[model samples]
Target: MAPRPRFSSVPHHALAALRQRPAVATAVFATGLLAATAVVNRQLARKAERENPPMGRFIHVHGVRLHYVERGEGRPLVLLHGNGTMIQDLQSSNLIDLAAERFRVIAFDRPGFGHSARPRGRIWGPNEQADLFKEALDKMDIDRTVVLGHSWAASIAAAMALRHRASVEALVLASGYYFPTYRPDLAAPSIPAIPVLGDVISNTISPILARLMWPGLMRKLFGPKPVPEKFAAFPVEMALRPSQLHASAEEAAMMVPMAVAASKTYSEITVPTVILAGEDDRLIDVEQSVRLHRVIRNSRLRRIAGAGHMIQQTEAAILMAAIDEAASISAGGGSDPRDVMTTNG
Candidate 1:
């Protein structure tokens, strides 16, 4: 009678109902997690935007808004940065300023990489990006310019040269990844970038994970040579913002396929081409540039000694020299007779 007094209010049927509906508890937990993650993501995004506002102008091309910065005036020299970066990467190295001194420098944030927007349902391959930028250039009345691309962007520059041969007068590819090379680590982000679940993951855990891993990744990217203090000072959190993280992951996921397809057309690029690689390039083997140089009939390959993959940052002088040379060749100055330089260690 004493025990019944305390338990009389609780019904056996109510306890049975709670035990039968565990899924409801799970759903509530999941929804709460997603809601919390969304809130945090928004706060982080706002902070990033406030700290790193757009440093360039925006133009609409092919139904997508693209961000770009233009400086100086002369022959138009277009700069395209690689994965996980924006126009700042080139600007940080002063490549834009240096090239602007002699050429009209136009540095673009490839679709989704910076302030640019990637339209839904777009695959955004190198060819697609090349065509989109070409259209943008057309709208600006800019044509037949030297296009410089670093890392993954090298493929885009090559695609531009091949697909819009008349518009791209020359190409300077730095730390480029050519040929189909399988990289297992690329799959980590790739999986999370797929459709519905990817959207959730990218907005939730991906940005946080990316921020944590970025420091280590930077070290690897500049191995055998230290990352310059200036480059390290870049607003990295901007790149880790949810939208950019998703975009970069998507691009990285598609890289292998893009390279496989683009490799077939390397020999077809007829524009004056300059391939620059660091002798100690840890991200991409210098041999890729060598092979690329071999295939592109009008290419010259230069290997910078003691430089890592980020030649644009660590070896601006060398990169500027290559850009200048490419600009010269594009203006009918002709290629340096030497097809390849001995590796400098």
Candidate 2:
């Protein structure tokens, strides 16, 4: 009773079995590698075009494919949308419809966000994305132009101005995010390597956490503080569609560091610039734009009341006014933000 059952002796064969488990070890290692590889591929597949603007063709640059719309023939005005949304969101925005009349409004899907392909193993932060745009413009023979960056695009615009100051004529940063401190609410999408186990889980299930706690995620980015019916007429649903999910996820992941890096260069910005923000912006703090306005020498800040993060979506008229104001102010024609610039008039 005290002795109980004696323990069985360790088997040499069991030790041998453990040593011979290379197949099992290889399988396990392969599983992890495969998981990582699939994720890498989805990130790589960013080059595939899912949503094409009914207007523009796809351009390939350094293994990346970008979707952009080139409308009008005057001075080039390149438009960049924020994270999660692409050129379509900007196209849906009045910012485009309003600005295209006077300037050549060219809007593009940043790599990993829109119809453009995603390049893996690298951060497509503002610097890289900005560099990509300069290359694209060079390819298009656009030596000088205006660049308007919205949301995260603002980071890219800042980078563009910093890197190639002379190439860009004027910079209009709307709801820009080149702040040093990241908001606490920012969430990163952990994209998986495959359809179900990887991207599916990331694109679908986990967002439920946000949808449940903060239903605002389900809404459109602009306000009256709720999702706009026109933008999110359908829900966020699934982000798997390449144009929506991967690009947005990468942008989200890259936000904080990119913003911090770009913030340092503001005071150095020499371009005639304008900082546009919503007084009630929920996505990024208004101070970000305000500070940017204060730091840049020639930059001015325009804050629209009762507007949310989607200033372009919510306060399009005001944003257009600001853009026209920037152009007028730079040209020494008008100091007022409301100066009209209609070619017909």
Candidate 3:
């Protein structure tokens, strides 16, 4: 008989077994891909950190280190950024510098968003974040300051106003997401931020997918208006790092439930409130700001025309004016007549 052909030094039995159990082959391939992805992700993360170092100082609050940047020297003004951002979001837009010229501007990276730490096994909703920030401000001897929160931070500002009323003199809520609205898109990250496997996915494939999706999502966020020129230079890669991505997912997941609970307590905020919304805000409805203005008895609402969700960057002049009005009202001075302009889109 002719010599039998040997299969590339492999046993026919093993080859047949692999073919019989296709799932085993798939699992092996998936494991290799995951390992490779993890190695590449680690290298990229290290490179990003080396390129973009921390831009602020750190202070320990309840044994958790918080990062913040302060400027100017006048009435205290605390700036809290939205989800997926750091203090640089305010700094790059020159909001901190502009406010700093007249007020002691303190901009913070809310726990887990930047260099700040979010301890494991902790659920940090708006209330939890408010309490943590309150402790940090207390350590810094900061009290009775105007708190400005953009987007998701808006809810945190409201929580601070409600829980720590004595410390929050005024609130400037820009592009605030109030009144729990069903947003299926926003709910995407909620599942992946759970425990165990969720943690694994967030640290692995989540950041990778986020990095890939950022460009399109950012375009939508600044739609009907161009993204600020300075934003091009923002360290987005660093924000997309694994830890930050996980924190962002957690925050996004918690937003709706937190807003639902906090919306009921809007009337409790007695501080002078300034609700700002861009007429073209595509992220959160501008009507939310209108509702907020109605609920907070002392609120002044400003609807900016031709502006997008990022009013702090797009309509800085108007936003700054609103901040000034809020500060004045908090100081027992009446609201600015210019601030009560009619809503126009």
User: Of the candidates shown, which would achieve the greatest lDDT relative to the real structure?
Assistant: 1
TM-score of each: 0.91, 0.74, 0.92
| Better structure of 2 and 3 per TM-score | 3
Report the lDDT tens digits of candidate 1 across residue range 1-345: 466445564677755665789887677678889879878987888797898788889899868999899999999999999998998889888888898899999999888877888887888989899999999999999967899999989999999998998898889999998898868878887866799888888888888888788878888888887778879657887887878888888888988888899999999988888899998888888889988988888899998888888888988888899988888887775655647775453
Better model by lDDT, 1 or 2?
A: 1
> 16-101 in candidate 3: lDDT tens per residue?
88789999978877988877877787788778878978887999988788999989999999999999888888888889888988
Clashes of each: 0, 8, 0
lDDT score of model 1? Answer: 0.86
- lDDT tens digits, residue span 215-235, model 2: 555343565556555565222
Model 3 vs. true fold: TM: 0.92
Error of 2 at 236 (Å): 5.5
User: How do the candidates rank by lDDT, highest first?
Assistant: 1, 3, 2
Worst 10 residues of 2 by lDDT: 336-345
Give the Cα lDDT of each candidate: 0.86, 0.69, 0.84
**Strongest candidate by TM-score:** 3
Angstrom error of the Cα, residue 173, model 3: value is 0.5
